[model samples]
Target: MNVTVFGATGAIGSLTVAELLARGHTVTAYARNPAKVPASWAERVRVVIAEISDVQAIDSAVAGAEVVVSALGPSMDRTATGLPLVDGTRHILAAMATHGVTRYIGHGTPSVLDPEETPTIQTRLIGLMGRTLLPRAYAELLGMTDLVTSSAARWTIVRFTAPKNTPRQRHLRVGFYGTTRIGFAVGRADIAAFTAAQVDDDTYVGRAPAISH
Candidate 1:
């Protein structure tokens, strides 16, 4: 598969790129700073530098790619800035559609899931607090969810809770809307592994899988 990963220099993006390459897929890592892309991948993959929010730039970066993966978390802690998530996601989706690319895997927060089905009061409270304190982010994520849900392409929105820095466990628990506390905590590598896996399988297409370790 020829894969393009947006925000490829980010924490999760970098790992996903590596995993994809390890699996022998041709990977393209897209980021604003090409220097941020690892030197090791320089020879094996193509690096495209451009702002993800720019429609033309995104279109060019994803062109000719079989699958698009987005790990586009805010560069900085934006709990206070309250930047928009859906707008960026919309741009990516639009770019993909324009380029005639269909398969997509997007990284999303667990807070976007309904709180009623969450495992414990703590998880629900945290999600509620996030919605209260960072309403814009949550709202935009909701919009992103709606867009992906409505899109005609094959898409998987991987909803994850606290992302740990631990090593890859190679284990994951996946659940859809009805599963409570499906995604409580997961390692970054584990998330990357699943993301790479999704490029080949349409198992999660048109579904939001809450992932946990």
Candidate 2:
């Protein structure tokens, strides 16, 4: 697979790129600062310098690639909003459509899934707070989902719950949107491996699934 990964310098993005390359897939990684990529990856995979918000840049980066994966995230700041995640996703989808690339996998938070499941009180409280307090980020994430799934493309949105830097494990749990039970913490490497697996799995297309240990 000729995979193009946006946010290749980010935490989960870099892991996804490593997993793809370890599988012997040719990867083109898009990063704003190419120098931020590890020396090993810089030597192994093709690195393209570009911002995800730039449509032309994205189109060129993913050209000739079969799968486009995005792990883009917005850093939290009081003065900042989540426009980067929302707008960057729109630009990525537009580029994919224009370039005739149909397959996409995106990183999202598990918190945005609709609460149809019988979740623990702790999880339910968190959702309520997100809806009432962090509405901007919540709305942005939901909007991204709507754009990706509605587009003329095959897309899987992977929602994750985890504290940072957890260790990888086989047989990680998957919770589909609206399913019962909240997912526990999962490792970053596990998330990468799962995304890599989804490259060929049609089962997850147009759906959102939460990943955890």
Candidate 3:
């Protein structure tokens, strides 16, 4: 499989690229900052450095990709400007359509509720905090969520809560809210593992599962 990763410089995204490589998949890493990519991955992965808003650059990145994973995360910065994540996702989807790519795995929070779910305590608190403290980002994430779910592509929005800088918990509890017991925190490497595997796994298509340790 040819997998292209957006936000490849982030903590989880970097891990995802490596995971894909380890799984014998060709990976094209899309990152804004070249310095953030590891020196070790230089020879093993294809690197694309450009702003998320550059439609042409984004299209180029998704050109021949069979699977597209967006590890683009939201920020809590109140001053964070614009809907770059949402808009960049729109561009990615369009580019995926331009080519023949169908599989899309993206990241979101529990605050972006799945249609079948009722709000849980964690979701309620997260929603309250997002609406109060991170209004712009919350709105933007919702927009991004809308685009992915409503798009023509096969999309899986992996939702989570606290992402800890811990070792991979190979065992994970994954389900929608109110349906299963899930913890508030999870390991970043664990997230990368599950997300990268989605390229070949169709079990979660059209569904957003909250994953945690």
Compare the candidates by TM-score and give the number of the best one. 3
- Which candidate, 1 or 3, would have the higher TM-score against the true structure? 3
**Per-prediction TM-score, please?**
0.86, 0.87, 0.96
Candidate 1 residues 26-142, lDDT tens each?
Answer: 988888886787889858988888765677877777889999998876433454554455677788788788889999888776655532343455546657976886666666666
The per-prediction tally of clashing pairs is 0, 0, 0
Per-candidate local distance difference test? 0.77, 0.78, 0.91
Clashing pairs in 3: none
- List the candidate 2 regions with Cα displacement exceeding 4 Å: 114-126, 177-180
Model 2 TM-score, 2 decimals:
0.87
- Higher-TM-score candidate of 1 and 2: 2
User: What does candidate 2's lDDT look like per residue over 3-120, in tens digits?
Assistant: 9998898888899998898888899999998679799874788888877677788878878899999877655454666567778888888878787899999877665552343455
**Model number with the top lDDT:** 3
Put the candidates in lDDT order, highest first. 3, 2, 1
Candidate 3 structure lDDT: 0.91
Model 3, residue 118: displacement in angstroms? 2.6
Clashing pairs in 2: none
TM-score of 3: 0.96
lDDT of 3 at 114: 82
